[model samples]
Target: MKILFVNTHYFLPQSRGGMANTLDQLCRGLADRGHTPGVLCAFLGSRDMFGLATRARIKVAAMATGIGAAHDAALSYPVWRAWHPVDVLPALAGREQPDIIVAMGGKVVQVIDAARQTGIPLLTQVHDVEFDWHGGDFAHIADVPVVANSQFTADAYRTAFGVDAQVIYPFMPLDQYRTDTHRRVVTFVNPLLRKGFRLGVEIAALCPELPFHFVGAIPDVDETGRELDRGMLALPNLTVEPFRGDMRDVYAQTRVLLAPSQWNEAYGRVINEAQVSGIPVLASTRGGIPEAAQDGGILLPADAPAERWATALRRMWNDETLYADLCAKAVHSASRPQLQAETQLDQHECALEAAINDHRAAHLSGCQLPA
Candidate 1:
């Protein structure tokens, strides 16, 4: 089946963000399974949207690869952005002839337009429950197939809108995260306040001897990045680094993955990614984190004080036996059969197939899909 993904996020289809990485892996993974997958996105990315050098790089890639030269490049590996995707979706779908369209990025408006314009089957992955019916996004999604990234997110939807969403853990290849580099730095990925930057700062403040590296999801070179990063910079023990396309370099130095998310994360991809390297995670028991962290995680209450977080950090830093056990558990947690990319990809495939068939039936008969 040909699957075209519609992700409107500025960082997506190229993977400068975590969700984009998930979608990119999903596309390539589908191709490996003898199905074609493609991405359709917006051009106005936050940065480097039309930087001459960036545009040159994209143009060169298009020239070099042309189309279908590589595996499922049959979709031409489209690097496009639409101001109004609803206007462009039909023409693109007509050319791509995608068997179905999946929307993983946080845009239901476009997917709804797609159903009306092209009659293509629609499947949405609830990357986060960050938005709501009042957000003007969920109000129209009563019939769309929802695949939540975690059980907690599915449960939230069930409680809020009575929608029974399917759960498909984000697809990640555990073997790829194994790093031979020395692991020593205490690491935190994406230090936004909602992601609990303040809590991370407090922990860093309490543990002055431990080195904490805050990994940014985007380039923190901008004024906004600098301004938001002031708290972590105030501490001598902490260091902030901006996002680069590849994360293995950051993972290379990470002795412990610190994820103190203040908000309900739909899924904490970093927790799982860290475990793949046998690195223990000190994360908040919030949202889907526990699902990803399992026994490998040294979980704490999201509302835990800075003292508690610092104490845990100190323990992880000083207790060799505990650390070693967590390391083994981390590896085991990551290696679990259910967390494998192929495993989740298979589930995603089944979900997509069912969604397509179900959409066909619903549109033809005007009946609601069974819960």
Candidate 2:
């Protein structure tokens, strides 16, 4: 089926975060399976394109859909509505004539209206706790189906909105993330406060001998590589790197993966991404880390002190036996049957087909689906 996926966040080649990478894999996987999948995103947004860096991002969005679909924020809106994305998704949908619309984030209400206006099947994807800013407003879009990134995310929405979302882990092409070189750096995928950046920094500082790599996942890294430029880190052991479209570049040098998440993550895709390369993860127990880490890695409290993280890092660095065990477990966990790329793609196809059929049935009966 021809499916049009909508996400407000940056798609691949814009942001190399785990979500973006996996979504790219998802689209590519679908395309490989004889399905045409396109994506619509805010793409550096409609407002504040004045900076040279912002304009560069706009240019980089050339392959917006990554599947040869037209993508551009609507430009007809007044200046006051600049904060909002250019709202032309419905018109785009009308022209693309997709059998299904799977909207991810940003102004999802707009996506809902687009689906309703275009009379297309809509499936909203919940990637995390903050899937929608207007979470309570889900009652309005009760008829729509949901595809969650993990069971934790699905359960959260289920408890809050009485929505039974189908859980489909994001697809990660493990082979793409594998690397030959394993550097000594302990890597953190995205270094932000919410992602436990403070803890990661503290741990690095505490362990003077251990080197840490902080990979920025932001679109432009605020143009000047914000994390590295600050010069705030007294310890020279930590290196802040800019976002990379190809994570193998980062993983190639990464010995251990760190996810000191302060916020409750929906599903830590990066752990599995790193694990596929036989890299063990040391993460927090805030949300889906346990689920994602499974038997592969170590988990500390989100509020664990810097000393605890440093100790863990030191042990992982010094103890070959423990490290080897965790590394083997990481590989085994990543190689699980359900975690395979083909499996993920199959799940996505099945979910989309089911959602599409449900919408068609509802429309044929001339009835709004029961919540």
Candidate 3:
């Protein structure tokens, strides 16, 4: 099948977030399966996220509208700024005549018109809950199947918009993460408040004997233009690091992964990444994190006190037997058949084919597509 993915954000390879990684893997998976995959996105900046050229398997159609970083930052909804450029999607679709269209990054509003115009089977992949941007409004688009990254996100859509979504967990490249080497440092990525940076600092302070690595700075800055939280920097045991796309190197030296997110994450990709690397995670029970962690590691309440996290960290580090058991479980969880990349790709292919068939049937029956 010829699949075209329409994204609001620049799907650059250097991008460190979960959405970019998932899309990259999906495109690669489709191409590896002998299907044609293409990406259509607006150019956010000169540099791509991966700091590398686009892969040969995936064809890219980037719309350059001369809207630079300053303009993007000023907009309340930066993604909507790409709507003007994305207007070309219909023309592109007409020429390519893709078998299926996947609208990602809550850009459904921008793509809905083009998708309807093309009369192609459209599937909206919801990555997060952006209430302010009306991300869930994609459910109202006729004949467009909504695919949620997790049951937690699917339930949110059902509850908020009365829209049912097919749950397809994001795929991760487990092979790249398989490593036997493990260091003693605990690693945490994207140290923003939403990601439980405060909790991480508290844990670091409590376990002064053990080293803690804090990776990635908060994207936003305060009125004074300071991004790093002073409290976090003050911790003697904590070592701050820059954000990177691939974390295999970091995981290679990480004994434990911390994903103490306070926000309701759609699906914490870090948990799966850590598990695949045989590093147990101590994630909060926020959104789909518990589901992501599964039986690999411990899940504390979202509002769990610092003391609770500290205690858990201490036990996991001090108790060799418990640590080994969790490590074994992590590997087992990641190696599960259901979590395999092939399994996810197969599910996605089936869903795409079904959507196409459903669309064709509806067209033949002279029936109006579902709202």
Candidate 2 deviant stretches above 4 angstroms: 45-86, 131-136, 217-229, 367-371
Highest lDDT: give the candidate number.
1
lDDT of 2 by residue, 124-183 (tens): 887778745643477677568888888888888889789888888778878887776565
Q: What RMSD, rounded to one decimal, does every model reach?
A: 5.5, 6.4, 6.3
Clashing residue pair totals per candidate (backbone < 3 A):
2, 0, 6
Give the clashing residue pairs of candidate 1, or none: 42-81, 43-81
What is the per-residue lDDT of model 3 for residues 182-217, given as tens digits with 9 covering 90 to 100?
A: 667999987777888777888889888989998887
Compute the lDDT of residue 140 as modeled in candidate 2: 76
Pull out the clashing pairs in model 2. Answer: none
The regions of model 3 sitting more than 4 angstroms off are 47-85, 134-136, 222-231, 367-371
* Residue 42 in model 1: lDDT: 50
TM-scores vs. true structure, each candidate: 0.84, 0.84, 0.84
